[model samples]
Target chain A: MRPYLYIAKVRMLSALAYRFDVLSSIVIQCLAVIASCFFWIAAYGNQQAALGVTRDQMLTYTVMSSTLACLLTMNVENRIAASVQKGSVALDLLKPVNIFGIYLWEDIGSVAIAFLQNAVPLLLIGALFIVAPVPASAAHFLLFILSAAFSYMINWLIAALFGMWSFRIVRIFPLLCMKGHMIRLLSGSVIPLWFFPQWLQTVLSFLPFRYIYQLPLSVYIGILSPRETAAQMGIQFIWILLLGCLFFEIKKGVTRHLLVQGG
Target chain B: MPLIKVNDLVKEYTVIKKGKGLKGALKSLLHKEKEILRAVNHISFSIQHGEIVGYIGPNGAGKSTTVKMLSGILSPTSGEILIDGLSPQKDRKRVVQNLGVVFGQRSQLNWDLRLGESFELLKRIYRIDDRQYQENLAMMDAILEIHKFIHTPVRQLSLGQRMRGDLAAAMLHSPQVLFLDEPTIGLDVDGKQAIRKFVKEINRLKQTTVILTTHDLGDIQELCSRLIIISEGTIVEDGSLSDLIDRIAPYRILHVELYEEAELPIHPLAEKIRQDGTAAVYRFDKKKVTAAQLIEDLSCFCKMKDFRLEEARIEDIIRAAYHKKEKLEGV
Candidate 1:
């Protein structure tokens, strides 16, 4: 545990080392959020409400979900794939500490830094200009925070599980790109699930992607009732457990076929 | 019992046979042809505590593969490795706590952080107590002198400095077994000497068993008490340096400068291979003929101005050993 904490600490320091890269990413995320808010505003054109929600609610959802997207995205897949390609994964496996735990802590460290650098600024910009709605009450806000934590875990586990494929596949970048596009389209980060067709909505509800962005953002906007939020949070926990198990299963296969690329 | 024991270890890699061009790529996608390459082929050896053994072989001879298997980075296809009576594959975390590995071509240090920070991370990872950590640091510093660049970022340090830092990092936990895969590679004379000295001191003080793979014969001559030479994924020779030389290169060269050129009389155990002006060269088998007896027999006929005995060079000896296996396999 101490080792894991130190790994996270070292990761955090390294993530913060590149000031220009951090600043540029923050700018890009800010543009993405503002563009998303404007897109929602244009879609809602002169209408007080659509899909059982007002324009303000839709705007709030867009801002919060986009911000969450920026916060929850973890690059562990790319990191792992690159390490595998370069054969540095052997060095990582030499440590006594768990390799998966190292990836998780490194993600935590980078995400913690990203939160300070990207999410806070984007949220402040959203609040100042778009006038996004606050949570309905303190309880809803607490639930949103809890759901967001689960969202991070789910997103990270998905990335890590996908990263395990690098052990078997030579070209992983295209697959990773496909995963990103799928998550963006399905997780309701770009377009809220409410706007999707009924069949797509049902499909998403059955999938874990919705828990990554839509569920937490919905809680933040106070759209879900108390009972619904409880049920959804339970579903989020289930997704975490399921994904966690899948990750370990894939990890077992990965170790069995582990090929250190270069000496 | 030996601190480390390996029995008939083997590692095989499955390489996909892909042809050239887009047609081959498409064909490979549909019908993959797989080839199994046995990198470490049923090789077996053991090392006792505090022994600095050189695990040497030519490139792609499975030296790195063997090290990886021993360190639990790669699972062996068959056979068993016991580090202090524990299998690294079955008990990786426990076994790794007592083992340290260093690859000269790749570094384990975090390039983003200062060297000290990397050491700190290793300390926590290994759960070394503060007292032990401090003592080890002192020992490493005394030998490696890593403090000169401890505060420098790993990327900023020179290759020599980084190697020193890496050595210190691996030692921070005071591991009992150390695996160094070309630790002195790509280093200057001073850097190589520093690493060699460090290995010697660590083994002497801590009784840490070291298995090193290196192409540099100087390292073998200075550090390793025993040599394990692998060729074509098999042990070609394993013994002391002198013993190996004697086996692969069985004779010594004697250069004698006589007062005048003459037909050199040779004993049954010695062969006169070269004669130029007043100088003559005789190759003699050490097992059968002593240099003194050969010199006495030759000197009685002609007053020898000067004479010298030369053993075979280690490079030639190793090359012969490596080729000896290839010739046998060819047959």
Candidate 2:
């Protein structure tokens, strides 16, 4: 655990050297959300309180979703895939610490960066357009925070599971890119879960993807009442436990095939 | 106690072979031939503490594979490796805590970060205290001249400069054993010589055990007292430098330059193998004759203007060993 923090801090500081890349990414992602926010604001302007969602409420949902996206993303899969490909995985494995733990901390490190670069700015922008919804009360906000923590674990586990393919496949980037794009689309960042048809929304509720992006954001936006939010938090906690086991199993399976080349 | 020990180490790899052409590539998706390559086979060697041994071999000779196993990078298919009395594959973290490694082709330094920043990061990763860290930085900066580019990013440094810094970084925390795989490769003559001098100095000053694998013969000739040449996954020669040369190749090339064309050397001491106008080459065996005797015999037959003796170098002997293996296999 001590070394984990050390690696995470080092990696974060190293990443800070590339401020231009970080700044560019923030600008581009902000533009993307702003473009979608305006389009949906226009769509809600024509509706006369349809679906119990006003223009402000719809914009709030978009803002909340984007913030959650920022907190949840940090290139965890890319790091694993890269280490696997370049054979640098050997160096990490040879370290006197758990490789999975170091990577998870590194994942969290990137999310901390996104929290600064992505979540705060987008939320500020959303506040300018509409009144952003906080949790129902302090309890609801605390629950949402806990749910967000579990979401990090679940998301990392999924990425680790998929990243294991890098050991066997040559062109893993295309597959990883497709996976990331799909997760973004289905988790309600590009398209809000509220806008989806009732049946599609019900089907999506069964999948854990919503807990990471959609459910946590919805809890922030007061879409789920107190009772409903508690139930969703229970589901997220269960997913976290299950995903923890899966991440360990995938780690054991993948490292068995680790071929460390000398020089 | 032995700092490193191995028992019948073997590493086998499964590689898929895709046939040529797009059609074959498509077919490879459905079914492909899997060939097993034995990189290291039943190799067993151990090193006492503070011993610097040179591991040399031709291309595809499994030298690096053995090093990776001892360093805890790769696991053996079937064998046991104990570094400092701990199984490297089983107690990997502990093994690595006491070991350090440097690969010539792959750098451990962060490319975009400054040299001092990289050292700072490693200090934390290796858990070196501030006091020791400061001492190490000062010593390393003086030894490798790291202060020149300590503020410059790694990507901006010359290859030679980066290599010097890398050596210092690997030695930080004063790891008890160091595995250097081709550490002096691709450097100029002066750069190579500099690394050799530093390596010798460290081994003598610190008593740090060093296992070096390299294609460069100079590395073995200069630093190593004992050399091991492994070919086709087996050590063919393991002895002092002079002993290996004596065992493998017992021949020398003697060249003579005369004022006129003359090929008359059929004596017991020397034999003319080849002849060109005004020049002749002789093969002399020490067991059969001496260089002085061969020169004297050749001088009597032909009026010699210039003469020089050539013994089979380390590189030539290793090459001959490999070529001999290839010839026996008819490959």
Provide the TM-score of chain B versus the true chain B for each model in turn.
0.94, 0.87
Query: How much lDDT does each candidate structure score?
Result: 0.88, 0.78
Error of 1 at B120 (Å): 0.8
Candidate 2: clashing pairs of residues: none
Give per-residue lDDT, candidate 2, residue B298. 70
Candidate 2: lDDT of A59?
A: 71
Residue A165, model 1: Cα distance from true site in angstroms: 1.0
The Cα error of candidate 1 at residue B4, in Å, is 1.0
Using all chains and alpha carbons, the TM-scores for the candidates as numbered come to 0.96, 0.91
Model 2 CAPRI quality: medium
Interface RMSD of 1: 0.7
Candidate 2: residue B148 lDDT (0-100): 83
Per-residue lDDT tens digits for candidate 2, residues A1-263, read 56677667766776687888988877887787788888887876778565665566567677677777777775767887788778888777656777777787877777777787778888777677555645556765776687778888788788887877886774589998888987887777677777788998999888888888777766765667778877888988888888888777777767767755434
In model 1, what lDDT does residue B227 have?
A: 93
What value of lDDT does candidate 2 attain over all alpha carbons? 0.78
The first chain of model 1 has a TM-score of: 0.96
The parts of candidate 1 lying over 4 Å away from their true place are: B274-277, B325-331
